[model samples]
Target: MSMRVAVVTGAARGIGLAVAQRLASVGMKVVMADLRDAAQAASMVNRDLCAGVDADVSDEASVQQLVAGVVARYGRLDVLVNNAGISPKHGGRKARVEDTALPEWQSVLDINLTGTFLMCRAALPHMRAAGWGRIVNLSSQAGRSRSAVTGAHYAASKAGILGFSRILAEEVGGDGITVNCVAPGRIATAMAAAVPETVNQEIAARIPLARLGTAAEVADAVSFLVSEQAAYLTGVTLDVNGGYFMA
Candidate 1:
């Protein structure tokens, strides 16, 4: 059997980078996609097993070109990790809904929600042809529940991902493609670091785990969902929130 090929978006750093590293470690040829610094990051992950491609997930042409380049080089694409998203803050704090500009809202939706849609659309054909695939879209605790730390646009975009994954999962299960989501909460990443330290400390006090979750922890969940062991699972939202929220 040929080596499996995986594409991980927003893989230049943080949770995305961690997931890319994990996948490459498992022997899959990984394509680390990001708007910038992706090649450098992929080199750090595994020069022999990983390649980085520049792509704007929100742009349809860019997405098509990205997947085309991957298939051209690797001959197949078996896994897609849609981890590209943005949670913008204002003056180090979440902007209230009333304060959020139209552009900001559209930007969040374009990247977080629409980007996932575009990537899946472009990759589904390859997966169907191969008769196997795994797709894991990154959601957030803000999407699962109320969040004071994130803006409304962020919450909406993340929630949209959950809905989108569920429908896609149902549609593609017959094709041997499993689509699912990983909703992380209070993860200690650069995104979370945008807030005040005291804010994070207060959040930690409320969680059962008593601390923020790590990027690797979230990556672990993603790794499982994309593995053969999880073949029977589809349309599920695996929460990696450290008991912060239960549904």
Candidate 2:
């Protein structure tokens, strides 16, 4: 088969960038979309199959442009990775839900949950036409339960992704498209580092692996689902938590 074309949201940095880079490494053409400029990220990562486009996953029109831009260049969409998400301004950033602003809560839902929906909805037509597609949503351990470090909105949005993926998986399975989610545990990143050293140590100590996960590790899980290996694995939430929370 020819190299697959994929759109990875929030690909400017951190986990999103890692996922985009991983896919590109595997002969996939990746369109790196982010709320911020992706030029720097594109320059830093593998360039052969990677391109950057500024996009706000939270906006309907922006998402439309994103899909159109990719299909315009790549001709088809083989994968959609919904990795663009925001920590609730008040909560996930070390504040409690009660302390969070209304905008923060709504923004979290808009990007984390609604953003995923928009991307999937916009990409569905293209996938149905091709009769093959892979939709991977970036969920988190918070989705499974309230994380000590995450706010209510962040947890709620991630959890919403799980339910959304399951329903969409069933809706599109017959069309040769698979929908799934990957919930990552604490990874060695700026966001994860926000937790105090004490907190980090405590969480890591509790994990069977006794360490935090790497972005590449999360990428590996996503890579599998988008590959032929996971054709039958739809509507599943693969935990890349490294024994942090096993369910």
Candidate 3:
């Protein structure tokens, strides 16, 4: 049997990169997709088991080309980790809803929400044809509850992912495809480092872990969701928030 092919978007760094490395380490042929430095990142993961592709998930054409290229090279796409997202900040602070710019709002939705839609749409047929697939969309704690650290647009896009994953899971379950979400809170990634250190410390003080979560920890949750052990699970949101939020 051929090795399973997994594509991870925004994989040049942070949680996406960690997930790619984890999947590759498990013997899957991993494709790390990002707008920049993807090839370099993939090389760092495993030169023989990983390949990188530059893609703009928000652009329909780019997404189509990305899937086509993956299919051409691997003959199948078994898993997709939609981790590409942007949380714009000003002076390391979230913009107030009333002060948020329209363009910023649109950009967040386009990348965080629409990008996931495009990647899933392009990859579903291939997955259904194979009769097996795993899709893990990255969500945020802000989406699950009120957050002072993230803007409204970021929260909306993430919350939209939860709803989208549920509906898609229902539509594709009969086809052996499982769609789920991982809502991470205050992960110690470059994205999280955008804010002041004191801000993270304050948030950590409120968490049961008393520290920020690691990217690899989040990757571990994703690894399970995409594995056979999780076959019976679908349309569920797994929280990796270190007891910061419970629902």
Candidate 4:
């Protein structure tokens, strides 16, 4: 089989970087997209199969450029991972809805929800033309249930993803394109590190696995979802939460 091409957003570090590396390991040419420069991260991966490109998923022009660059170099797009998001923190805690600023809420929705929509819209044409594609949207456990740690905006954006993905799956199923989501819970990333150590420990204690999940673990789940083995799967949300929030 010809090597497939994948684009991973928010890949400068943490879960996104881990996903990029995992895809590359499986022989897919990977494009690591982020707001910040990801050359260093991409270099650490197999250079021949990976390249870093700067992009802000919330911006249409930037997303277009990012995908164009990938196509210009790789000639095709087989997978897209929408992982860029923002969960604003104030002194190690999410702001209460009563105190949350409009700008903060809009910004989260833009990047977390709107960004995912833009990426899928931009990539779907390519995928449809090719007649095969895989899209994985990153959601959170907070989206499925009331969140104790995250704010309303964050939870709302994630919940929106589930609805958006299901509808898209229905629309694209006949085109050989699959749209799925992954809801992660308290994964150990830079974003998650903002939580107080005491809180982290408490969350871990409640999880059936008795620990915060690792980025690589989440990446493995993504790898499976994008693989041929998951060809029959679509419109599903696989939880990588270590049993913290079981559906």
RMSD of each: 0.6, 1.5, 0.5, 0.8
Which ranges of candidate 3 are over 4 A from the true structure?
none
The positional error of residue 6 in candidate 4, measured at the CA in angstroms, is 0.1
> lDDT of each prediction vs. the true structure?
0.96, 0.89, 0.97, 0.93
- The top-ranked prediction according to lDDT is 3
lDDT-superior candidate, 3 or 4: 3
Q: What is the lDDT of residue 230 in candidate 4?
A: 98
Ranking, lDDT, top scorer first: 3, 1, 4, 2
Error of 3 at 217 (Å): 0.3
Cα lDDT tens digits, model 3, 109-196, are 9999999999999999999999999999999999999999999999999999999999999999999999999999999999999999
Q: Compose the digit string of candidate 1's lDDT tens values, residues 20-82.
A: 999988889999999999999999999999998889999999999999999998889999999
TM-score for each prediction? 0.99, 0.96, 0.99, 0.98
Off by over 4 Å in 4: none
lDDT (Cα, 0-100) at 203 in candidate 4: 91
Q: Which digits, one per residue and each the tens of the lDDT, describe model 4 over residues 185-217?
A: 999999998879898999999999999999999
